[model samples]
Target chain A: MPDGGDPTALGFRPALETVIPLARAGPIMLRVGVNGYGTIGKRVADAVRAQPDMEVAGVAKTRPNFEAERAVAKDFPLYAAVEERADQFGEAGIDLAGMVEELVETADVMVDATPSGIGAENKSLYEEHDTPALYQGGEDEDLVDTSFNARANYADAAGADHVRVVSCNTTGLSRLVAPLEEEYGIEKVRATLVRRGGDPAQSGRGPINDILPNPRTLPSHHGPDVKTIFPDLAIDTLGLKVPATLMHTHSINVTLDSDATADAVRDLLRDESRLFVIPERLDIDGAGALKEFALDAGRPRGDLWENCIWGESITVEDDDLYLFQAIHQESDVVPENVDAIRAVTGSADAAESVATTDDALDMGF
Target chain B: MPDGGDPTALGFRPALETVIPLARAGPIMLRVGVNGYGTIGKRVADAVRAQPDMEVAGVAKTRPNFEAERAVAKDFPLYAAVEERADQFGEAGIDLAGMVEELVETADVMVDATPSGIGAENKSLYEEHDTPALYQGGEDEDLVDTSFNARANYADAAGADHVRVVSCNTTGLSRLVAPLEEEYGIEKVRATLVRRGGDPAQSGRGPINDILPNPRTLPSHHGPDVKTIFPDLAIDTLGLKVPATLMHTHSINVTLDSDATADAVRDLLRDESRLFVIPERLDIDGAGALKEFALDAGRPRGDLWENCIWGESITVEDDDLYLFQAIHQESDVVPENVDAIRAVTGSADAAESVATTDDALDMGF
Candidate 1:
């Protein structure tokens, strides 16, 4: 009946305090594998490479295409996500380092960035290899032990066998909500997601010429996925797919527990590393300028790693807080994946982990 | 106290019911003088032209520019908004029909599309001519007797000497709020405006590389502007300017009087002539595609004249409703302007005015 200091009882490996320092002393790098190198996966692999303590073990792809060539050009060890497609790389004159299973076996953690639903299929394989894994928002909630947003619940993932990095919209909602939930206490939250029709490379998907209510179901699954993070939080989310490939924009309204000024809310969010309170002067007015700013600022693949919030847009009327922020669909999760690696491996606590990830990735704008 | 039959005592002209029908028989049209040939002004002028019962007496411009030429090409008798700038038209090889004052004197009603403060400045000119005036949202609240949103309060403007068509944002907000207020009742409202940095042609303005909290003030002026229409409503708004000229996107959350479903809200909005509940299938996702859809759909100036609400984005949880919709900053108000003409002149009731304006402009897309 001992409740304290039992690593086995707590269900985690030797405490991160013991394990992380040892890995640091030996100069041994954590091998991180990225599966499904598409919009999210490619960015995750690059972000994994950015961390000083971790190295990308390899990247896995279902087919030997442009992304496969990209994986080779980046010098990332390429693995076949589908065993049957192993020869596609060799025939395409690309050499393969191994299959995804081998990558899972060799790496310390595998980030499942495969297309939605495919991650669920790959989960058994990661489990067979006893590899702690990270899944993107596209996957089901059951596939992960917890839905992760570094700022919201970084520590929750520590020693967890599987973690799902919430979708871009949820990650965005979580970042904004966490501050309110912690600093002001959220009474209820409602957000409408103006989602991009598809990733920039997703040409085949869309209501290309119209605005459609994606999922046609009330309170799109995004709300429930967010619930996975804050189980008691009352949230309702509605999603719309627009013919946009750049980023998703979220209109958030949070009813706080107490009345707070826009300035107070701004100050609170400003203090968070992941929430970039866009200065009034920068005038990053919309997703277009945000992307351009990212590209011009020389962000890798024009990535906006932090939420681009309109500082002037952060306003409070009575007890309600309203603001708009853009979420870069392709790269916002990259930093989270890096932080998740530390979380799952007992490498760092929340503050130390987030700070390291933020500093290494140059997150706060 | 003989208020029963006296139109003046009732604060409206019986001319709409009595004189209008007689004037129609005599081939006389309602002369609408558009003061200001900018983004809103030009569109209003054209919309006035489109009305079967009205004609553009003239369109006033500050300077002889390309817009003047466009006005000339459209054969709208162009007037000089600034008397001193009249010769500029001749110098630019564009002919001027008259000065703004003459247009005001000749027209039965003036639709003032002048820049924000300029509308106030021209209010005296309109008063001097004893002409009933309809001002755009840009003017100060006190400059007009009431703020008009056809769907929300069309009847309020009937026989009113002066009315200010609410801003693009306000007009859009009123359309959505009106339905909820009527069917379910709105307890409170919170909205974030993702506004266009400038109209497509106003290249001079913007946070060209950043998103800015436009107005940087809490509960942006838009809320009070909406209050100008619904004086008793409890609403709060936050505003952001994005670097896009196509349209303004609104993220709205309404705490209703009673609980409702997304389907109920969608059905309610669908019944509105001014609100275009973008279907779940067309996949019209963002300003870019919405604009493209408008252009491809062969709308003049690629204007999406109705509020583009994402159908699937309509969701209600508890007594709250959330949705994202785009307001074509340039033209959503165009149909509203036409409806306001009918409203102010007592030409139509709320439903009739809205329907006539919608049919005349091919609104409700």
Candidate 2:
């Protein structure tokens, strides 16, 4: 298989080896378990199945709904809550596991896609079984060992057992902010989160006809949320909710300590690999087309996984900077979860894992 | 009465004075004419009446609608379209010595709060009468000699005959970006605009359940739109729209050419008069409370009118920065409008005008 060479030679920090020690470990037949079959869990399971070295050991759903039936059809093992012993799975002729714990303990890595605070509860379950866990962005920043972004903080997750993916808003902000922070020292980060009311699967979300102010709280701790990845970093966030669902958009302003020109800053951002700086001349309309572009790029699950940055939005005078970017929360974090699995299991080098994952990605047309 | 000193001594730039001369030409009984009385116009009429230095010259509406009747109730010298009855004003005990053309010519200044493109057409009428005109934010950038912001560019409008107020998005960006640019060298500006589907009066505003990308246009030209005030700015913008109505939120990212710390940058921003740095402990909730805060601050309109910046969002690691803020477009621009009027007409000293305008704002409870 494509072990690709010495894991240590993969340009990763020395600490990563403890997590995934490279012995002649015959391609570890890792079992992947997903606790929640919501938007994120579904994507995670699908992605895991596509990996050459991993398998969707099984997945657990809270209810035996349409999604559960669909999972059953895939011939992947399915488990339903004991209380919901509804024979939906049996009717679908699929063997059903008794409980979520079965799926959790059976897997080498468990990804908890439960709603925000619920991830903390599953964190304990994953720990009890000594099964490593990957978490979604919704969980609080304090819950995990570190927040992982394959490109930005792959090494940070090395030798760690638990990782939390920052919220969709934070993921988008971190990706854009990291590049700028890397190239230019960031002084202040001011952002307005134009959040979507509900996911396609969710119907109860929204302010409906009214333009409501989400939490007027400043620095939403989102800047700090990103900091879980880059500690000792100072950042703040302000948030707002709007009626939209496909993607989250962020307007950002940064004040640098020293004066730099706009062109110079743009040059720095362009150098980052995962960030695709949209040129000023593209007549691209919105996130939809960008999503299509990502899909066309053959990203698995139609994920426009990279941050789509607009070029003209770069402005610099004195030492300040401003720009805008769109972040697809669903897919951006998907790739990270894959990387985390490798980190916790000590299966591959961070760089090698990232490269392989990038290659494995179906950059779909 | 608080002219303070030579109107020219007030840091007023000569470039701005060439367009709108100081009304210091002695309490000039400037005749005001309103062609369309929609949301903005109605507000303008109220604002004009609130001014001790200016008086209602005359008003005109499309027809006898409830709005028109409301304007009439304000005791505004109302005139029907000269097209409907060329002699109606004369017959209704109103002076018609000069026709609409002559009326426009007679006014010292005309404020056009018509819909977007309509303001540009009225320009010639104002010009024909040797009167300067103030256009609303909806008009395109190229339609006027200058775009005005009392705090940032009032001096730029000193002598211009025609001035445009930038779009609400532009106005918000400019206010926030200007101070950052001034205190810290601005490197680049990126913004995602979560725009409202409609104003409060429009019923078909939004269902806002789907997050759609507004325009994938870069630099949203908002930074450039702001540059109309400070022409030398190097700014770019990317814009996205979310279904919202209360106010527009922007997520801005700025990259500095050189390295600076986040704390240093935050300190610089805190000093700017136009920006209201939300203290870390205020516990304010969202745009709604911020609006109320602005109103309680006695802002003329219940919008923050200033950028509601979160201090915590300011982060610095090496050279990157991040931040979030909310801009109340409706009322934020109002103060700028008042200042622009003074700037164009040379009616008040820049310092005095700023102070008075600031004091007049009803920030709200």
Candidate 3:
């Protein structure tokens, strides 16, 4: 009887006006469908679910592997990425809602998590469904309307139909550069990326026992990618693939337009939501221990969502700012994906979305 | 008569001039005593013995510990660093040639390898013995006439009574900066030292789980130490203590007065005798793997004597050069100590001494 007073049970009592909760009636929960279900894809789905006003519509997978089983266990409705391979899910005992196309059409937004080149191919399908999609860093810039980094260019992505979250290294660099460019005005930037040989799950690739210049060229492609965000920002990046699999460490040196102290730069970066200036007390010095700390903290997949900057490593002399920072290769882009979803869908403004995402994920760990 | 024409051995006649072969002894082998039989001291003794123009006068130790045992195993005459402890060695059954004072008086030059502050205290002992000494990086620059990095300013140390081989970090930075400054004029330099919490053998130090800004100040002593070599070079340095103990990695950024390509910078570094540009095919990526490769390749203590610069990590854009390089804290300074001995004694000029030391040590590994 407490569920809602019935007028008939109250005899001649005047019919009471039924009131519906505004949260339940105001707007439909935004459904976000994720495709690919790989390293970036799996993280994106979890981040999407973390938003207060959003719900994961479903996740599409190519095969009914462990990840698919994981998706089911996490209670995410699974869909088939390839129609021809749909029966594989049933064989694996993972029930699918439908094909990837149905999920794409059903959701208000889709995050394309396919391998690098494959994102370009899936763009047409996103267009067909008229669903706004976010792409991962592996895809080229031209594949999307604009490359996205929550802290760097959130406003630029507002209402855009498709956005690409930059790579882990790019996200890491963008986060550092954004604060410098805004507060100090960057003159030019130079960064050397000590990249991981491969992600933890990637077993077959490597230089294994050797050191090689990846492109064997001056200024790797990363510089151009940074340019995509700050088109006028002068930057050059050198790449090295080390045997480590946990994270990518960056040696960054930036020349600001004007002089700034190392302390000032540290203070500026600390204010940004995505940059985690590692304090001297934590002793999270190298990538090995940093990853171990993450795992010990019970982070899902041991993800460190913020750029880990060595606090004491920030040194400024004259107009130069020098520092060492590590980027979690797998999960830095995860939070960016959440922010980009809001940016592309106009669900929230930059500040609100960034704050909400940062709060929900508990960044700066 | 292969044995001097002895009829009991063979019937061969010996020429009267055959006895003149002793004249080929050339220059008297410079007797170099290593005072402080710890990490750098022990290595310096071995390096001196390896030189065709030099020999280890003797090694001095403060304790009859494992290192003393190892010194004896290597057939090095051991002298007690502390006179009070001299009897302890005799009690421990370590046969000593004499006291540390006797070793200093016997040698033409002495290399002080004591702890940082103790090196400064040992200055009077060497001076009393009239033996010019080469100090390790631990001592203050004022403790010596000049700080020496063999590649940076070998000529400056020639005939100087006191020459301090710069610290492992400084030596590492100087090795990189010297080539860049010579090939292309350097307007300014910035470096970040990702320092080891302690050497591999230091069991008592560290946050173990924390990264600390060692001095918590801008422009660590490293920048000033660099100024000792390049007085006019403008530089700033930041220091961070990480958990790793194997080696210290440096993130170096230099602003050149002119332009240069990645290949050009790499070629210039490659030509230097002490700088080892890790080739692309070897896959020597991180400090961990680099150490492993060295150990697997049978390097003594798995020491990488040369600056381990990743070939592909060198990038030049406009007037800025950036790269990542690792300095094996233990042995990089070993070769420098040998060269410093030659410089202080005026035994050889820069090129000949560097070449001799490099060749003897089988450098560029």
Candidate 4:
């Protein structure tokens, strides 16, 4: 009777308002098992920990490594990715909660942040457990029923068994394209991607002193990746790889179906929680500066989940829109992975999931 | 009469394919005085040395520096910029050929590459010697009646008393716009300028690890500067300063008056002598890589005088055209400065001047 919260039955006058989530009542928390435990995986696990309705079931790693030790240190109940390598963790002085299969069976949903092609191989394992899996952008489109971007097509992933979150560039494009398409119809999108050469720890990758065309062709793979979210939208993407390892800078131009002023578009973008419209007062210059700002702001690993859109660069002339935005490749998709968990599990709607993920992860500048 | 080729008088014994000039008939070599022996001035002096019709009368510097010594090593006479401080060169153990007044009187035209506002102060000196001067882009638009971009407004500077070569960004834009305006016609232009922090040696100028909006406003000064060359062309630019010290990258979207295919635009831009449409096979990534490539190719100072326009980025959707081009801030304007010399002196037509400067500097990729 006390748990039912029937104030009238308790013989006490009911309060003027009843808080739906009474102090005693908590939201349903889902156990999300993170696979791969690398850049995307570890960040997503931490994000899940921040969410009110999500908790890290555990993290699965291939073998005993620094990440596995860090996972153990976080008390995340580390699991061995390979059953045969389970003894390796013990030898490395790391404790394993169980095998990855057990984590998969226990988790409400599995986030596969494994390297690109490995996710495809992990599919059968996910199917064996009958557990829904959310794969990262590196995975092929055919591996999942739909490619996911929280802003562009989050609902397309709701209640879905297999979902693929697009790459950083695609995610950035989708986030910008969503509101524009919603507020004012979009005709075509053309983006020039100045991508960073590699992640901070990548040693073999390069352009160390150069800028190379990612594909040196028209309509790079990024445009098709974006199409996965908005199937009918026409987008042409050209990519260039630069020496910097900071972030990807995109020069975007969207031809609108109707006329809109720069101010109007700025307002529309500002309203979006994920689009961090950089104000004029803040002197964020490029990806390097953005990272400094994020680190100073005490964001986890200085991960920026928002599209750092230069507010001043958003200009409109007739039906054309132009803007420059920088996307922190390593972390922008982390929140999307978190939101994708809620999406695939049907735990929340797009707004609810995004809001929850944003609040928990401290999204936006 | 022997110096002047007359086919009528020599017809009786003239060969069927007689050349315009005999081997002994030398061309008119103009004495070009270079004022200010810094970055642009030194390059110009070397370019003048390479030109068959031009010679460096002397280079003037306020104080004896390494550049002055270097100039003397090249067998070019050096002059003191500050007449009163002429003894400074003697004290520095750098011998001067003459004073500024003598250099100005001896030269036919002066190329003023002095610090920004200093060019305005030197104008009276050129007038006192009844000499025309070609000023660098740093000088105000009002400092000269015409601002010169060889491809865009070479004729406008013809025989003018004073002329200013547009800035690096403006020159890059002008070169790209020239052909587009002639073939497709432009409705309007919107550009995003990702500028370098400063020259390689300017220790104090920096974003070092930040991306700062140069002005954090719409319609940056660059757009108006471009208009100085093409008064009626509409352009809006947003400026950003990054930690880089190599080049300025511009994201451009032009609303063309007519429709054109991407291939056709690429072909047009490729045909331009000064626009190096980066070939996909070259694999040059950005400014840093470009410098490395140029150094490998044995270019002087690894200077890229051409506008590095990405061929793959050229896209067309109905009436809108989009592309990204990088301007080498240090050396792209060097050729333009050379052309401005011909412009103010009326030494050659636009094509002739451009060809002469290009051949002299070994320009283009």
TM, every model: 0.79, 0.73, 0.80, 0.86
Which 10 successive residues of model 1 chain A have the least lDDT summed? A1-10
Looking at model 4 chain B, which ten-residue stretch has the lowest summed lDDT? B12-21
lDDT for position A323 in model 1: 78
Q: Whole-model lDDT, candidate 3?
A: 0.79
Candidate 2, residues A1-365: lDDT per residue as tens digits? 11112434655433244324433355655678888887888787887888877888888876667778778788768777444564666766656866777777677678888778888877777766666678888887678778887766777666555788676667777767676766676876666566666665577886554333455434565767777776766665656666666676666667786777878877887876566677866655456667666667666556776676777666764555766677776777776788778876677777888776666764322
In angstroms, how far off is A104's CA in candidate 4? 1.4
On TM-score, the stronger of 1 and 2 is: 1
Q: Write the per-residue lDDT of candidate 1 for residues A25-85, one digit (tens) a residue.
A: 8755788899999888998888888888889999999998898898899899999988887
Q: What is the lDDT of candidate 1?
A: 0.80
What would you estimate as the lDDT of candidate 4? 0.80
Per TM-score, what order, best first? 4, 3, 1, 2
Which candidate number has the best TM-score? 4
Q: Order of all candidates by DockQ, from best down to worst? A: 2, 4, 1, 3
Error of 1 at B339 (Å): 4.7
Indicate whether candidate 2 or candidate 3 has the larger TM-score.
3
lDDT for B285 in candidate 4 is: 59
Q: Across residues B84-107, which tens digit of lDDT does each residue of candidate 3 receive?
A: 877898888888888888888788
DockQ of each: 0.19, 0.27, 0.11, 0.22
